[model samples]
Target: MADDGLDPRRWAALALLCAANFMVILDSQIVLLALPSIERDLGFSGGGAQWVLSAYLLGFGGLMLLGGRTADLVGRRRTFLAGTTLFLVSSLLCGFAWTGGVLVGARVAQGISAALMAPSALSVVTAMFAEGTERNKALAIWSSVGGFGATAALLVGGTLTDALGWPWVFFLNVPVAMVLLALGPVLLSESRGRARAYDPVGALTVTLAVSAAVYGVVRAPETGWTSASTLGALGVAVVAGAVFVRVETRSAAPLVPLQIFRSRRLTGGNLVMLLTAVGAFGTSLAVSQYAQGVLGYSPLEFGLATAVLPVMAVVGSYAAQAMIGRVDVRPVAMTGMAFMAAGCLALGQVSENSGYVTGLLPGLFLFGLGLGSSAVAAAVAALSGATERDSGLASGLNTAAFQLGGALGVAVASTVAVSRAGAVPGFRAAFDTSAGIALAGVAIAGLLLARPRRRRVPEPVGVTMSKEESTCGT
Candidate 1:
C-alpha cells in the first residue's frame, strides 16, 4: 500500500495483526474464568491470587510508553515479531508453572511482550490503510476483535478448564500464536518513524512511576491505605512521576513529547477511555466472581450465561462503524458511556436471590452494547488526526490508558468489595462504584469534546496543517 513493497495484501496482514491482538487480550480474560481453579490447585489465598492478574497489568501498563516509543524508533515489524515470540514463550511457561510465584512471573513476561505487540499492530494497521472510511472500517473490525476476545474468553475458559483443566487455557495460546508468527513474516510490512536518540532516563522513570503507582493501589486493600509500604510505594510513584516530567521537558529526544497534549481530542479521548475502563473492567471481575463464587454456577454455565455480551457487542460495533461518517465521535462516545452507566446502575441493584434471567441478562446486554460503541469511538478519537510519525505513540497512549484504568479499576472495586458486608453485597457496591465512574466519563465527553467544526479555516500558502491539529478542530 504506500509503495512499501512489504505487504501487498494489506487486508491479510491486518487479519494477522488482529489475530495476534486477540490472542493477547484473550489471555487476559481467560485467566479470570480460571482464577478459582487456579486458587484451589496452586494454594493461593486472598489478595495474593490477584498478583496473577496484577503482575500482568503492572508490566503491560508500566512499559507501554517505552514499547510504543521503541516501535517508533526501531521498525514496527521487528518489534511485533520479537514481542509475539516472547508472548508465545511466556504462555508456554505459564502453562507449566507449578507455583503462584512462577505463574505470576510468567504472566508479567506476557504483559511486557503484549505492551510491544499491541501498539505496533495498531500502528501498522493505520499505516496500511488510508484515513477516512477505510480506516474507520479497519478500526471498527479491530475493536470488534477485542470485544470477541474478551467475551469469548468466558466460553473458552470454561470449556478448557472443564475439559482439559486450567493449564490448557494457557496452553491454548501456543498454537494460535505459532500460526500468527509463521504467517507474520510473509504478510506483514515494515515501518518506522523519524530516527532519534533513545531517552533511557525518561523511559526508566515513567515505567517505575507507573509500576509503583499500580503496586500501591493493588496492595492498599491488604495493607491499610496509610500503611508504611503502601504510602512508600505511592510516594515513590509521585517522585518518579515528577522526575519523568523533568526528563521529558529537558531531553532532546523525549520518550513522550509533551506537545502531544496540545491535541485536545486525543487528551479527551484518552481520559474518557480511562474512565470507561474503570467501569467495564471492574464490572467484569465482580460479575464473574458473583456468577461462579456466589451463584454457584459451574464454569460452563457461567460461560453460557454471559455469552450474550459478545453477540450484542458485534451488533454495536457494526452500528458504530455505520454512524462514524455521519455522526461526530463525541456524541457517539457520550451515548455509549451513558448506556454503560445505566447498565452498571441496573446491575448494581442485584440481590442475593436475583437470578441470571431477571437480574444479570438485561444489564449484560446493555453493557456489551455500550462497550462496543465506546471502544470504537474512543479508538477513533484517540487516533483521529495522527501523522505517520506519531501514530505508534498515539496508539500506545490509548492502550496504556485502557490498561492502567483496568488495573486501577480492579484494585478499587476489589477494595470496596472487601470492605463491604458479604460477597453479593460487596459486588453490588463495586458495581455502584463502576456506574459512578462511567457517569464521570459522560461528563468529560460532554465538556471536553467540542462539536465538530462544520467549516474549515483557510491556511496560507506553504503552511500546511497536520491532520492531528485539523481533524478535531483543536
Candidate 2:
C-alpha cells in the first residue's frame, strides 16, 4: 500500500476485477436470448426449460452470503481463483450438455461459481482503494462495466446464437476465465479477516433461507402465487431465516454480525439497490416483450435497436461520479430514481401502432441513464461506511439484495403483463407499475439517507469515526 492507503497497482487490479464483474453479469443476461435454442436443442419438456435460468439464480442467490463470509475467513484471492476455475469447467459442461437435466445442472454450477467470484472480487476492489474520491471513481467504472455487460449480453448473445450456435454462448467464457485465472495471483494481494472460526450452522440456515426465498419468487409466475408449492417455499424461507438469526446471535464468531445493520447508510443503500433493481429488471422484461412480441423485431434486430440504453448508461455513470465528488449521495440517488420513474412512465405510453424511434427509444434512453447513475451511488453509499473486516459481508448483502430484487421484478412484471385484456395493455400496465416502484424508491431514499451539514476529509486507514459521523457524508 502507498502512503495514500491505495494499492500501487490499483488500476491494473481494478481492470481485472471489472472484467470478472462483467463476465459474471454477462452470463446472467446472455442466456435469456438463447433460451429458445437451448430448449429446442435439449428437448425440454413443459416448463423445465425455465430452470436453465432459475437454477443459476437459485444457486447464486442462495450461496451469496456464504461466499462473502468465506472470502473474509479463507482468503479473497484464493476464493476468487477457485470460483473462476469452477466457472471454466461448468461453462465447458454447459457447452457439451446432451440433455436438459445436464444443462440445468451445469447452469447451477455456474451460478455457484458466480456467487463465490462476485463478492470476493468486489471486496478486493474495496480493500485496494481507500474510501473517498478514488473509491468513488473506481466504483463508477465497476458499475458502468456491469451495465455494459448486461446490454452486451443482449447484443453478443443474439449474434453468437445466430451465427455459431447456442453452445458458443457457453464457450465464450472459456478464454475469459482462463485469462483471469492466469493473471489473478500476479496482480492481486491475499487478505483474510482476523476471526477464523467457521459458523457452519449459520451458513446452512442462511443459505437455505435465501435459496428457498429465491426459488419461491422465481417460480411464482409459472405456478400461481397462491399455490401450495409457492406458499411452502416461502414458509421454509421464513423458518430458515429465523433459525439463522438465532444462530448468529449466539455464535461466538457469527457468519454475519448483527451489529452491522446499525449503520443507517448501509441499510438504506442496500434498500435503494433492491428497489432500483426491481424497476430496472421489470422494465427490461416488459420492453423486451413489447419489442419482440408486439413490434415484430428479430432477436438480433431487437438487440441492435435497444443498444442505446447501455451507451447512455455509461455516460450517466461517469457524470454521476463527477457529481458525487462535490455533492453527497442522497441527491444523486434520488435524482437517478426520478429519472427512472419518468422513463417508465414514458414507456407506459406505448401503443400497438407506436414506432421504436418515437415510442421506445426515449424511454430506454432515460432508463439507461438512471440505471448507471443510481447503481454507482447505491454501491458507494452501501460500502462507504463499512469497516475493513466486514467489507466482504457488506458486499454480499448488497449483491443478495440486487439478485433477490431481480427475481421479484421478473415474476411480478410477468404476472402483471398477462393480467390485462390484451398484450399491449398488459405491457403498459407493467411499465406503469414499475414507474410506481421507482417513485417509491425516491421516497425511501429521502427518508432513510441523511444530509451531511459539512464535508469531511478522508481519514487515514485504522482511524475510527463515530457511527453517526460515518453515516453522514458518503
Candidate 3:
C-alpha cells in the first residue's frame, strides 16, 4: 500500500530479479562439491578450507541487513545493478584466484554482492506484486528458484569442476552476471522507500563483529579453541558486538530498527528461519563429506548423490504452490519442518557404506523433499505481512538469519568433529549432533510457528500484516 504505483513492467523486472537470485544461490552451492579439489590444489587444511565457505557467509550475512536498508534508502534498481556488477567482478576474481587467501577474499567480495542484491530483489518483488494470490505465486516461484538453483548448482558445478576445473565454478557466474546486468537496467524501474539516515557506524560494527565471531567458529576446526587466533577473534567479536548494540541504540539511523523486533511474528519467524538455515546448511555441508569420505565417492559422485535433495525441494515447492490459498502458512511451514527433522534423522542413522541405492539416496531425497517445502513456506510465512517500505528490511533480516544459521551450523558441526579429533567416531558424532540440531529446529518451529495458529483467526488481518511487516521490518 505504501507504493501504490504499480507498473506493468514490474512483472518482467521481477522475473529478472528471480533469475538473479537463482544465480546467487547457485554460487552458494556450485563450489561446494568442488571444495575438495580446490583444497587439494591449494593445499588448505580442514579448518583452513572452511574459510572458502565461511568468508562468503561472513560477508553475505554480515552486511546483509545494511545492504537491504541501503536498497530502501537508495533506489532498488540501482542497488540491484550495483550488486550484480560487484558479483560479476568478484566471481571473475574468484575464478582467477591462485592462492587460498585470494580465493577466500574473492568469496568475501561475492558475499558482499549477494548481501546487496538479494534483499533488493526480494523487496522489488514485494513492491511489484500485490498481496494475496498473485504475490504468493510470485514468492513461491522466487523461493523455489533458490531451491532449484542449489540443485542446478550441483549438476552444473560437477560438470564444470570435472571438465574445466574447480575455478570454473566461480568463472561460470561471470556470464550469468553479465546477462542479469544487461537485462536488469533495461527492465527495472527505480524504486525507493522512505528516506532515512544511512547507518555506517552501526553497519560496520555489526558486520565486523559478526564476521569476527563467524571467523572464530569457522577457524575453530583448524585453530584449537585455546589457540590465540581463535580466542582473539572471539574477543573482537564480543567487543564489536557490544559496540554495535550501543551504536544502534543511540544512532539516528540504525541498520536494524529495534522497534521491529517487538512483533511476535517477526521475532518468531526469524528464529524459524535461523533454525531452518542451520538445518539446511548442516544437511548440505555434512552430506558431501559423508558421501565422499564415508561412502567412498568422488566429487562428481557426491554431487550426483545430492541431486535428489534438490529434486525433492522442487516437489515440495510445487506442493506449496497448490496449498497457498487453501491453507494458512504456519501449518505448512510446520509440516515442512517436520519433514526436515525426519530427513535429518534418517541421514544420521544411514549406514556409512550405504550407497544412494541403499541408504544415502533415500535420506537425501527426504532432505530435498523436506527442504524444498520448508523453504517456500518459510519465505512466505516470514513475508506474510510485508509492506513496500519494509520489505527490504524483512527480506534482509530473513536472509541474514539464514546465512548466519548456515555459518553457525558449519562452525558448530566442525567444532564437534574436530573435538572428536578427526577420527571415524568423531565424524559420526558430528553427524549425530547435526541431526540433533535439526530436531531442535523442528521443536522450535512446532512451538512457535504452530502455536500462533490459535491467534491467527481472531486477527487474520493482523496476522497477515505481521508477516508482511515482519518481512520488511526484520
Candidate that scores best on lDDT: 2
lDDT of each: 0.82, 0.86, 0.76
- Model 2 clash tally? 0
Query: Candidate 3: TM-score?
Result: 0.88
lDDT of 1 by residue, 1-474 (tens): 447443468889888999987887787667877787898889998757768877888878888888888888898889899999999999999999999999999999999999999999888998788777878888888988887786778789889998999999999989988987899888887888888889999999999999898888778877877899999999999999999999999998888887776667778888987886777678887888888888888889888898888887777777788887898778888888888888888889888788888999988899888878888888887787666777788889988887778777877887888888789889989988888888888888877665545445553222112443554443
User: Mind giving the per-residue lDDT tens digits that candidate 3 earns over 8-113?
Assistant: 7777877788889888777776777788888999889854776787778778877888888888889888999999999999999998888999999999999999
| C-alpha lDDT (0 to 100) for residue 439 of candidate 2 | 89
TM-scores of the models, in the order given? 0.93, 0.95, 0.88
- Which candidate would rank higher by lDDT, 1 or 3? 1
lDDT of 3: 0.76
Candidate 2 lDDT by residue in tens digits, 324-439: 88887888888888888899999999998999889999999998898888888888888887677877888888888777877788888999998999999999999999999988
How many residue pairs collide in each prediction? 0, 0, 10
Which is the better candidate, 2 or 3, if ranked by TM-score?
2
Off by over 4 Å in 1: 2-8, 45-47, 451-465, 468-474
